[model samples]
Target: MKFLVDAQLPVRLARFLESAGYDTIHTKDLPHKNATSDTEINSISIRDNRIVITKDSDFLNSFLTIKEPYKLLLITTGNINNLELEAIFAANLQFLSELFVSHSYIEMTRDSIIVHY
Candidate 1:
């Protein structure tokens, strides 16, 4: 699976995914860097077939209203440190990859992963 990590997420998350053998890119890699707009990110996600990994509810709104970004992994694990966040992904990355194969919108919370049909 491929990923487009958003501005609110740390670049290390992207690096973690890359190290896990998934193709990944963080917003900082873009020309506009973290300033890259949600619309543009959505466009890139669709064009490149990347699943957006974000904490932004705007992408959730767009996904529900217009199905943009191709797929989404919404992080709802509020206020955790970056290392904790990475640990979550580390423990769940393989399952997450499998979930996305059959799901378009998935939510990751502190202790659970929810798959939305």
Candidate 2:
């Protein structure tokens, strides 16, 4: 699966996904870097067919209200270090990949993965 990592997330997460053999890009790689607007991010997500992996609730709102960005992986694991976050992804990567095949909105908390219709 392809992914677009948002600014609030560490670029290493994107790198990790890449290392795991998925096509991924971080907001820092964009023209405006982390300053890239959410609208632009959404456009890129739609254009590239990338699932947006973000901690931003705004993305959650957009996904619920308008179904933009094609798909979303919302990170709700609050205030953790990058390594901890990466570990979470590492542990759940396979299930996550499978979930995205049929699910468009998924939320990752410290303890669980919640799939939303």
Which pairs of residues clash in candidate 1, taking residues 3 or more apart in a chain or in different chains? none
Evaluate candidate 1 by giving its C-alpha RMSD to the native, one decimal: 0.5
**In model 2, what are the clashing residue pairs, if there are any?**
none
CA lDDT, every model vs. true structure:
0.96, 0.96
lDDT of 2 by residue, 56-84 (tens): 99998898899898899999999999899
| Model 1 lDDT per residue over 8-79, tens place | 999999998999999999999999999999999999999999999999999999999999989999999999
> Model 2: residues >4 Å from true position, as ranges?
none
Our tally of clashes for model 1 stands at 0
Provide the TM-score for each candidate, comma-separated.
Answer: 0.98, 0.98
